[model samples]
Target chain A: MKKLVLRLRDLPPSAWIFFAWLVTLSVLPFLIILAMSFAVRSESGLISWTFTLANYERAFHLVYLKVLAKTIFLSLGATITCLLVGFPVAYYLARATPEKRQMGLMLLFIPFWTNFILRIYGIVSIFGNHGLLNQTIMRLGLTDSPIEILYTRFGIYLGLVYNYLPFLVVPIFSALEKFDLSLREAAMDLGANRWQTFTRVLLPNVREGIAIGSLFVFIPMMGEYVIPDILGGAKEVFLGRVMVEQFFTMQDWPFGSALASVLSMGLMIAVWVRMRFEQRKAGPTSHGLR
Target chain B: MGDQRILKVLLNGMLAIILIGGAGFWFARKSNDSAQPVLRICAWSNYLPQNVLTQFQKQTGIRVELSFVSSNEELFAKLKAGATGFDLIQPSDYMSRQMIRLGMLRELDHGQLKNLGNLMEDVRSPAWDPGLKYTVPFSWGTTGLVINTAKVPLSPGEIPGWGMLFESPDPKRTSLLDDMREVFSAMLIWKGSTPNERNHQKLEETLAGLRNIRENILMFTSEPRQYLARSELNISHAYSMDALQAAEMKPEFKYFIPREGAVRWADNFAIPTSAKHVAEAYRFLDFILDAKVASELALKGHFSTQNQPAWDLLPEAEKNNPVLYPDQATKARLYYLEDLGDLLVLMNRMWAELKI
Candidate 1:
């Protein structure tokens, strides 16, 4: 016991405090939710102590499954779009002079200075049925009628991409900043074209950034409620919205907990699969680079 | 060796400061826990006027903390999650009844409430809470249509019932309430049935009717006032107060209870069973019921007061505002939503499907 105490004391105090805080705030609540997922709901919408699998069974219904599928599809679409749009901007910022890069980065972060909901509302005012976009188009004689832009699937996708674009760009930009440009020069000297150099050398070096950026966008987009609720006009259902309704509106705590548990498990599996795939793809070449 | 000793002393001093600060916080919290009576109220946003709350606080010498909820279900969930510090809660009539049934409300002592006689004869014995045992009526309004007159250009007489909304030529120009109960009730009333139609067949018929016109709807939203003001939506199902408030801002808008029928909703103040400041809660209830205070709150909120003297105090213009005080024939058609019990789940499922 004396040795154990001495060993614990040898570690930095900050690390000990951080570990304690994480366990208390994150781990404990997650464990409690996991425990509640197996509980039963009483007639009056209260959680009962008796253990049951009914909540999990209810979570597997066709409607919930469909919602989960739709959410995944939307998340995947948003992530892919972010990656495609963010890559060029990140590359340019990385290659720019220091002052120019700093200005561009400041511009990127300026949107975040405002409240998130306020930003979404700004988008609404711009793209609403009687919004600036339609007014401009009509005045320009572009069309005879107003275009339906807000409260559509396209609108939801646009909002998600706009909000999360910075997350993707910042990571890729930082990764490119640390990238060894000599590798690209070597590929070109070896008679490889620009595309080949990019694919073979540049892509592999910044694969970590791509993975992280995808994760930053994908995970939050999966659980996104406000964007779809406001922009989608409650026309379509999303998994996060359903889970929230279960907890707040329906007051089915057991079912909500069960849904949340399943979603977390699914996200974990997805992340694990992605890591394994990236590892396998990077195996031989990554070894040579190291 | 000297530097190490200094570091040790600095760390010990930091630890001492933290300990002292934590002790101070604990002691302060303990002292505050017993110092003053605080009346914690949870109600819908803008339900109680700020002036009324301030007056109550001044008179009673008690601090009042206010929290707002968007829906009764949210309030219920908060109470269920052991939000026991709340001394007063404002729930709709049906929700109050439901809370009373669930043993979540404190029975009111009528003897302590001197202004109980101020309540109008009709509201005194509401069907939901006969004799007002557990709740007191705060404000009442009807769920109705708010139209952008500049866009739709139809008078109240020309545009008749729910059919004007359901069979709208341009369904994309109309919006409906997002609430399941309100939407379902509207459908039931449109189909010439009661809002509280409990029969499964009648509900199924209403669901089918809603499905037929579902595509016409622009959206189901709780806040259609903004859309109506912008003329993005020409017609919307809305509460009378919201409609009136929106119309006050944009004169192009007008609110009307459909000639067919509409849902009449009453919000009530009730004490929770776990209330800590019961005396303050009672005082607040009586204070708000005063004729002048009730009149002020009603005028500000743009909802009808249940106090007869308060009604009398209303200006002729406000008294004649059909939206606030509908005619007797319109009042005859208004129905309050009842607690649906087990069928609520079914209704929720049906509403979800309709949205999908």
Candidate 2:
């Protein structure tokens, strides 16, 4: 038994176990969904596994394709907005005195410890037509009418920024913490101006952080149903709402699965491209750091 | 090496606790929970008031745990999974018949229900389950056009028909129900056929008529309250209860039963054969059947009273309201939605094709 244990320990602790677990849980669910996309749905709402590309063909119609494109566009817009808002805040937090920084970091995390649904309700209470913001604006005589804000794309953007800001902040904060401060100081000392030092030294160092943050935001923003459903009303149509309509209201499971698989594929391609870019940036550093 | 070993041990301990604690607590809760008797109710999120459950608990000392299912398909899927986790379920009349045929329903002991006689004559002997053998009627409402009278023309004593919608002066300004059964039935009635038509040619004709009115429809929606509150569109075909609820919120909003007649449906509470809290479930049903409780529900919401005594007991303010209790002639022009069986599936497919 000792000999067997020694042999097992000597094998470099194979990562095959983790790979198997991932395949069983994550990859299998995706494959099942992909398989379901090609199945046929009967009038009785029964799904039959008679291989067909009809669902995909049906999905290619102009209305759905336009909605898919719009979803991608919304996700891209949200990801960029998060990075722009989060970068300075993260940098400020990372560079603060250690004592104060802990408190700021804790403040950022305190809201997350509460239920996600409750946090969303908090946003609604603030921005609803009869809510505080509208009441305040109307009281101040900014305009005669309450602004049509909550159910528009503006509302969707506000919701997206509120929910996903922390994801962007956390990773950038970690990257900033591990950042080599000497590189920036040395550049500034050697006649590089503040902007020059920041652009040349700080930006390149945080590429990984931006990629990680964008991936976190972009992937989820694609499948985000609740935020849009609550905030967008019927004015804007996202891919998530379309898929839900197919499954629940329309009773077309195969078509819904097809839409889900298409969304998954889009997200996978995005993550893959981001990883490749990261690898290119990290080419020499992993070995040099070691 | 010693420091590395210590760090490794600490990480492993944390990981072990996270995984095992989560799984163990879940498993322990599942098992420990199995021993306690729960009257599992599968229904909409807020179909029944919370007071009903608490009162039943007070009287019977049994806890009722509710599991919400959002749609008909979801309810069926849970039942099909052989999850006996539910003791009582609320399904519409069409689905109640299907569940009964599938042997998922338990034959109720009518002797347990003293208020069974209080149910209206029409709801008691439904065509779906004749003589109310396996189901207990709860709430019912008709599907009709709810018009904003401030916007739509209202001639003296001239009732609007389905033609106001299908042949609307402005097609782009109308709205319709998103439900297949209700929409298709409305279309059928518009085309001068019986609402329960099995004829394929008649179904196609109905679909074509729906297509004509499609452009006029601003949008199809289930939450009519949201749209009505905004006064987004002037006309909407909706459940009478939903319309009444919205009208109460916005007084200018008015609900009318169309001249071609509309579909009415009843939602029922039934005991599943696999129930563990049959006694408590019955007790809960009986509590809601009480005149005061039923009246309170009807007065507060858009609910039409099935209890005649409760309807009479309500104050004059409520009793005079036509939305809650329509006149005899308006009631005569409405048809209760019967189980169309295979014809429903056919109608659903037809509606899908038209939308495409």
| Per-model lDDT | 0.85, 0.76
Score residue B47 of candidate 2 by CA lDDT: 61
Whole-model alpha-carbon lDDT for candidate 1: 0.85
Judging by DockQ against the true structure, name the best candidate.
Answer: 1
Q: How well docked is model 2, in DockQ terms? A: 0.10
Task: Point out where model 1 deviates above 4 Å.
Answer: A1-11, A277-284, A287-290, B1-38, B57-63, B194-215, B320-322, B327-329
Q: How many residue pairs clash in each candidate?
A: 0, 2
Measured with C-alpha atoms, the lDDT of residue B101 in candidate 2 is 79
Q: Which lDDT tens digits does candidate 2 get at residues B1-356?
A: 55556656766887999999999999986886676655778876546677767776787777788888877767766776578878889888777877887778899888998988888776778877898899988777788888887878788776688876777754544667766777788888877766778888888888887776665565566666665665555788887777887787777778877877778777788988888778878877777778877787777656677887777778997787665567887677667666565565456445545553
> Cα miss at B104, model 1 (Å)?
2.4
Q: What is the fraction of true interface contacts found in candidate 1? A: 0.43
How much does each candidate deviate at the interface, measured as C-alpha RMSD after superposition? 4.1, 6.5
Error of 2 at B57 (Å): 6.8
